[model samples]
Target: MNRIYLPLAASLVLIVSLALVEGKMRDRWGTPGVEAAELGKRFDQVPKKIGDWVGEDLPVEEVTRKTAGAVNYVSRLYTNSKNRNTVNLWLIIGHSRDVCRHTPTVCYPSQGFRQTGDPLKHHIDVLGEEPAEFFTATFSKEDPSGRHLERVFWAWNHPNTDIWEAPDNARVHYGLSRALYKLYFVGNVLNDENTIDSSASVDFAKLMLPALNAALFPEKIADTVQSDIQPAGDAPAEEVPAE
Candidate 1:
């Protein structure tokens, strides 16, 4: 009887300890002050014209927006003026838990689109800043209209740091933030065999990063590039007529 009671007591104490730890974690990482309205305004400020890509708004149904838990979002179709290639951009800000669960791996399958392969991490070299990383994947569906294919690149950005990250587990990585931003760059896959290096979506991402930085981090922007400059020191002595 003594042994039985001792083990039961120990188990109960372990459960209580685990519960307390979970509560503390939630308190620390679950709630943050994020202004949804101000973030919405900034989302609107991203330019419609990024380099040669011109954009037009795409309507998002109210029901869908609610389902997505989006505080604010932009859905747009951008077309290149030079080659007529097009890409769709979806950018949204919302609670981290809500936004992180809606990745293409889950959403595309529910819509009857089969993933072509495992998603890969792709890095884009943002001019004058650190390279941004994203997850890229392709999916396809067949229907009365015909077979359709899409390639999508996605990543998350924390509002305070303004750095884009593609974590293996975004929900955990961003769980502390009250609000998070998720961006998707999607384009039709013309050929499954072709490498994505030259895709319009990739090119557009390179062109749009600077504009996005300006819109999202206006206060943080600075001229990082150095032009012609003379070394700081006393001016060179004037050439004298001496030998």
Candidate 2:
């Protein structure tokens, strides 16, 4: 009788401790100034034209959208004007728990695609800011038509920080955030490409980062200066011309 009651009491204590930790985490990370709906609206402002890539909206099925659990999302195809290569962009914002669970690794397999190799972490240099990090993976599907290959790069960032990261566990990493944004750049692989460094998706990301930052965090953009203009007293005196 003593042994049975002791084990049960310990189990209850463990359960309650876990609950308290979760509650504190939520209180710290889930309190953003902007609501999820308001942040979702900003997705509309992300440009349709970024550098040489011209974009057009892609229709997302109602059921598919609901399944993703995104409060807001944008699915579009951006085509390069010169090379004619195309990359698909999917951006979503929602609760971290919902947004983080459905990564390409999970969804692609469910759709009959097989992972080709272990995912790799890739970094993209975003001008005027720190290099953005993403996880890249390749998947292939076989159908009657033939084999189809896709390379996908994905990352998540909090609205306030605007710093993209590829975490080993996004759900746990962002569990406290009020809302989270997830971005994906998917491009078709042609001719069994060996490297993703030169992929159109990567090139497009380089051009898209600044535009995305401007749209999603306009206030931050306003605070940054593109030029090197110095304050009145900060400028050095000009030298007079010698006769």
- The model with the greatest TM-score is 2
Question: Relative to the unseen true structure, what is the C-alpha lDDT of residue 53 in candidate 1, on a scale of 0 to 100?
Answer: 91
lDDT of 1: 0.83
Overlapping backbone residue pairs in candidate 1 total 0
Model 1, poorest ten-residue lDDT window? 222-231
How would you encode candidate 2's per-residue C-alpha lDDT over 1-243 as one tens digit per residue? 999999999999999989877775454445532466689999989999978889999999988877776778889999999989999999988777677889999999999999999999999998878899999999999999999989999999898788999999888788866678999999998664667788878889999988888888887776676344568887889999999
Off by over 4 Å in 2: 1-34, 226-243
TM-score of structure candidate 2: 0.81
Indicate which candidate wins on lDDT: 2
TM-score of 1: 0.78
Per-candidate TM equals 0.78, 0.81
What is each predicted model's overall lDDT from 0 to 1?
0.83, 0.86
Give lDDT tens digits, candidate 1, residues 183-240: 9999997653378777779889999987887887777664332223445675597888
